[model samples]
Target: MKPLLALALLAALAAPADAQERSGIYQQGEFIDVWNHRGGHVLQMVQTREQLAATGRVVRIRGYCRSACTILTTLPNACLAPKARIGFHAPRIQGTQIIAPYVDQIMGSFYRGGVRERWFGGWNRSREMQVISAREYTRLDPQARFCPSLS
Candidate 1:
């Protein structure tokens, strides 16, 4: 019985970190409070990635940072805001397949940028690598005008 109980405990401990449902407004002193909320489903949000284009200069984003959101943040004009709480983990795809390239690029960029590992402590047991392997997207063209959001 003791061994059985130990196995159960290990299984529970080894379970994947479930995606959380969280929503809130993140405020940074550089500007007004940027609004944020959960969208689509858990572990996801509707970020105004298109809005970054309009800012022209570098724009920092603060939110419940994770895979999808991290990719969104990689857009040329995007930067991480001080208030951002990043969930440093591998990006999920469809439902199961983890996209390697995307994860490599995201994690590589973060590592190069000197992001702390403490930011990613929650991802220890995940089979997905913290790094993404993806092609680099084009940086925002200085001369290109940002189109407005229709939604």
Candidate 2:
């Protein structure tokens, strides 16, 4: 009977996480160059942010999130991991260094807190990657907090 009880506990612990547990967390990962069609990228980010906002889940940023992924920092439920690093840069048209002001304007709309201020302050103008640690970002954006994990 004791062995059976131990086996049952082990089985329970091994069970797959439910949707509430899985979708509740978003792991911000590495790169994918959205070289062109930045307008489409902006649209998708807005839609994703809206859906995530409605879910009441937590978006945990980890590792290095670059380009379009940085836009998700706008999520109202966003949480920054201890080692989180985010990269930012101006949107450029396909195959050129020319900055896309209209696309960048849409991207800027997603930011709040000091992030928005910084965006307007010219972080968005960098042609090359501009990286910031989670702590620095949190300092600029008070809405985010340090959270490597929920517990």
Candidate 3:
């Protein structure tokens, strides 16, 4: 679908801001928290994407979203804010520095094309978190378009 058409559809189907917020839906200004250090479980993130996909609601990444939260990028209905920053790092086994292949596999399954090849090229291999701004991320993955003006 055309970008504008998708945005228009979201606007039309979207519930009121307060209600949307309460229901864990994106409403431009608000964000879905996916912090890195919090290290949300990989399987849990898979479930998150499934749930959000079922809603057919637009998921916007505003402000900071890191780690497993970035998995939401796989959502077909996802969007990005101008100031968005997404962080990634090697998924480590809890309480250890060892990289978790299972976690990487799950995350890798969700991310493909440029997202898997370039963004995670070095980023996911390091324990150090790497962040890409909305501008950079858009260049890397054109599928993630910027959110439209609702007003």
The lDDT leader among the candidates is 3
TM-score of each: 0.35, 0.67, 0.72
Over 4 Å off, model 2: 1-40, 148-151
lDDT of 1 by residue, 39-113 (tens): 222233222444434435444444454544543444555554434444445444556655444444434443322
Instruction: Report the C-alpha displacement of residue 9, candidate 3, in angstroms.
Output: 22
Q: Once model 2 is optimally superposed onto the true structure by TM-score, how far is the C-alpha of residue 76 displaced, in angstroms?
A: 1.6
TM-score of 3: 0.72
Q: Which 10-residue span in candidate 3 carries the lowest summed lDDT? A: 30-39
lDDT of 2 at 87: 79
lDDT of 3 by residue, 1-151 (tens): 5443344346546634443232222333333322222336778767667866765656766666777888887688877777777888888887789998767767877775677885457766789888889788878787778878421
Which candidate, 1 or 3, would have the higher TM-score against the true structure? 3
Poorly placed runs, candidate 1 (over 4 Å): 1-51, 57-60, 71-82, 97-103, 106-111, 116-151
* Residue 28 accuracy (lDDT) in model 2: 26
Q: Provide the clash count, candidate 1.
A: 12
Q: What residue pairs clash in candidate 3, if any at all?
A: none
